[model samples]
Target: MLYLAGLAENSIVDGPGLRFTLFAQGCPHRCPGCQNPETWPFAGGQAAAPEQLVERIAQDPLVRGVTFSGGEPFAQAGEFARLGRLLRARGYEVACYTGYTFEQLFQNGNADQQALLHNLDVLVDGPFVQREQSLELAFRGSRNQRILDVPASLAAGRAVWVRARRWVLDEQPPEA
Candidate 1:
């Protein structure tokens, strides 16, 4: 079961195309100036089954992508991973927004977090830094965040900026 703060049945802001965005409940990194402060608590969200969400997502044929937003999706990694697996099997592009960097998740995350990482096609990673916030960024709130190609990062064992034109328009990843 997935505990969600809310869901956007059709959203373009979350990704490149129309997407079904799931906002998980409960956030460990309560970044200041968060857009969704209501989602910071874990206890009040509506419980949803991943299968049911899949069914709901299927109702909209135009939504070919799914984005896991949060409340920190990794907090419920095991469940979200299952949902991501299901979504991928159905031919949906799966993306995620995470406060944790790929390096942190790669080197220190738990089994479920690693599993969830594997299931994503794209990952927008890093805590939202108020000082780094920018209006020009694409699909991200801060300059420190990255739009990563999940498979390549997993293979390289480091964060690899996605070369997709839609996600990155000459937005370079931070220097190592």
Candidate 2:
């Protein structure tokens, strides 16, 4: 079961294309200026089975993908990994927002967190930095946070910034 703060459907601001965004239930980072403070309590929010969440996503045919926002998605990496893998199997794109940097996820994340990383197409990584806050960054709250191309970054063994796909709100994604 996964703890979640909320879910947003048909959300354009969450990621590329209309997405189902899951705000996780608990967090330890407690980053200053967090957009969702209510998500901080580890015990808050109802628990949801991974399959049930995927089933909810499956009902929306127009949704291009899903974004796992957080109380910290990595906090329950194994369950989210299961959800990520299931979403991929259903032919939907997967993206995740994390307080942990990609390097930290790779080096220090548990087995499930690292596994979940493999299932992601995109990763919005790093904690929100109040000082690095930017109104200009696409899909990020702060300059220190990055929109990373997960598969390519994993393949290259380093974080790879996605230059071409960087988009402001309402831009259409490139066709495959």
Candidate 3:
């Protein structure tokens, strides 16, 4: 089961298109000036099965994608990975917001964490740095965060910037 702080249906701000956003409950990094500080506690939240979430997501036909926000989704990597796999099977684009860098996960994440990373299509990575916070960045709260192409990153064995026009402003991804 996955513990969730909340969920938003057809949320345009979470990703490129109208999407379902899951706010996971629980965090290791309680970054200062976080937008969702209430989610920092791991103990209190609604517990949901992956299958049940899939059904809930199905109710929204207009949702083109889904994003896993946090309270550190990596904290419940096994369950999130299950949900991600199910979403992928149903042709839903899956993205994730993580406090941990792609390199951190690639090198140090546990089995389930790695599985979850492998399942994602895109990942917005890095802890929210209040000093580097920006109102101008698209789909990210801080300058240090990156919108990554998961497949490319995995294939190249390094963090790779997403090239999708909707997700990035640059014509070409910067070198990894």
Candidate 4:
């Protein structure tokens, strides 16, 4: 079981294709200007089983993959790791968003965190920096975040960037 901030099915922006995004309900990194401030409190959000999430992920055949976003998915890496394994077993790709750098996670994070990292295909790491915010950036909110290829990084013993930016030409910002 895990505490969840929210869930979004058929999300195009969260990952490569239509994705089932899971927002785990606890964050230690309360980066300012965070879009999901409501998820900061670890105690908040509803308790859910990984199986329930699996059911949701399996609902759509066309869905490309599953994205684990958070108040900080690494906070409950064990649970997400389990879910990640299940999703991969079903032939679905997994992406995880986190505030910790890859080096930090490998050197300082617990075994569960390493386990979760091992199960992921892609990882978006680094905290959101309000001053570095840019609308043109890909899936990240700030310039500091990176889209890393997890398997490559682990094998090569260094971070491997997948795409420096996600192309979004002709996209207009919402009128404020």
Identify the leading candidate in terms of TM-score. 3
Residue 20's lDDT in candidate 4: 89
Tell me the deviation in Å of residue 46 in model 3. 0.3
Model 2 off-target regions past 4 Å? 166-176
Per-residue alpha-carbon lDDT of candidate 1 for residues 1-176, written as tens digits (9 for 90 to 100) = 99999999989888898999999999999999999999998888999999999999999999999999999999999999999999999999999999999999999999999999999999999999999999988799999898989999999888888877887754665543
Residue-by-residue lDDT tens digits, candidate 4, 1-176: 88998889878777677888999998999999999999999886888888888887787898868999988999999999999988998898899999999989978889999999999989988999999999877678887777787898899887877642342222432221
Please report, in order, the local distance difference test score of every candidate based on alpha carbons.
0.93, 0.86, 0.93, 0.85
Query: TM-score of every model?
Result: 0.96, 0.91, 0.97, 0.91
- The best candidate by lDDT is 3
Give the backbone clash total of model 3: 0
Q: Distance from true position, residue 113, model 1, in Å?
A: 0.5
Query: How do the residues 1-176 of candidate 2 rate in per-residue lDDT, one tens digit apiece?
Result: 99889989889887878899999999999999998999999986988999999999989899978999988999999999999999999899899999999999987878999999998988988999999997866688987777777888898888886555444342433221
lDDT per residue as tens, model 3, 9-109: 87988889899999999998989999999999999999999999999999978987999998999999999999999999999999999999999999999
| TM-score ranking of the models | 3, 1, 2, 4
Q: Rank the candidates by lDDT, best first.
A: 3, 1, 2, 4
